[model samples]
Target: MSKTVVFIQGSPRENGNTRALAALVMETLAQSGVASAEIDATRLQCSHPGCIACGRCQEGPEFRCHVDDGLARAVATLPDYDAVVLSTPVFWLGPTAQAKMCVDRMASLVKCSDAGALATPLRGKILGLFATGATERDENLDILERQYRVMAEYLGMPFVSALFPFCGVPAGQAAADPEFATVARDFGVRLAGMLGGRKCCDP
Candidate 1:
């Protein structure tokens, strides 16, 4: 069976450098015969006080967040996909608010039993991170990567790889960098191959 991937875009600017790289990745995945979907975090109807810790999802074996929003619907469908790609731009040395909101909403994946033991529905899933920043320095990127790594670990998911491209580039300029697109596409192809049980270079 062909592997399916969900690419979540966390940037508010639809045409930003992050989205450009994500688009290239998606295109390459499609060429490799891997089905892919894109979710725009900015468009989700998520609000503040995310994940109220209401213990609603813990009440049953089936995990589901009671929040009536797009994020709930998105999380409900994640188990159907083989892998997930998170694409975001660095904002103040971290992910954008939209991205963080989605991340917080993912708490629904964790099911706390009456005994207090925790289990996640996302266990063993493959996760990849793609991020961009306006600065050429890697400090911000390091912070972002660390955050993602921690999240993956908490969820018991494998942090396959991270693609950081188009750094220091202004909006709309990333598309002009042929090398950026080329590298992004290569990473995408490799990711798709990995999902299909064909090992390629490390992400």
Candidate 2:
């Protein structure tokens, strides 16, 4: 069966550098014959945005994300995919507020057993980040990578990333650079490799 990947659009700002790079990556994956879909955090219609720690989802293994909202419903099905790529712009030394909030609320997807064992639906799936930030990489983008690496390690998911620093200086500046597109295409192939896909056609 073909592997499925979900691109989570974590940027609140549309038509920006991050979004452009994300589109390039998705196009590569499509040309490689990988099945894909997307979830835009900006468009999530959630009355209760972020995790409330209500323990409703933890009540049973079958229950996942009990919140009654579009985000809850969207995240509840993440287990069905083979990979998830969070595409966001770095803001204030981290992922955008929209992206971070989505990640926070996804905590509801973790189902802990009565035996005190923690299990999340995201297990055994690949997790990747496509993030662009301003300033030097070590100063900001690397910081974001370190946080995401820790997150992937704890979640037991293999991690990959496309971190582009010194981007979006003038908002969408990176989108005009051919080098950025090349890097994004290469990163997409790397992500697809985790799902056992190879480039069969040009993107």
Best by TM-score: 2
Off by over 4 Å in 1: 47-49, 113-117, 197-203
Give per-candidate clash totals: 0, 0
Instruction: Give me the runs in candidate 2 sitting further than 4 Å from their true place.
Output: 113-116, 201-203
Clashing pairs in 2: none
Clash count, predicted structure 1:
0
Model 1 scores a C-alpha lDDT of 0.76
lDDT of each: 0.76, 0.82
RMSD of each: 3.3, 2.0
lDDT of 1 by residue, 92-194 (tens): 9888887777677777778766797769768888788888777754668777888789988878887755556336678756756888777688778778877
Among all windows of ten consecutive residues in candidate 2, which has the lowest summed lDDT?
167-176
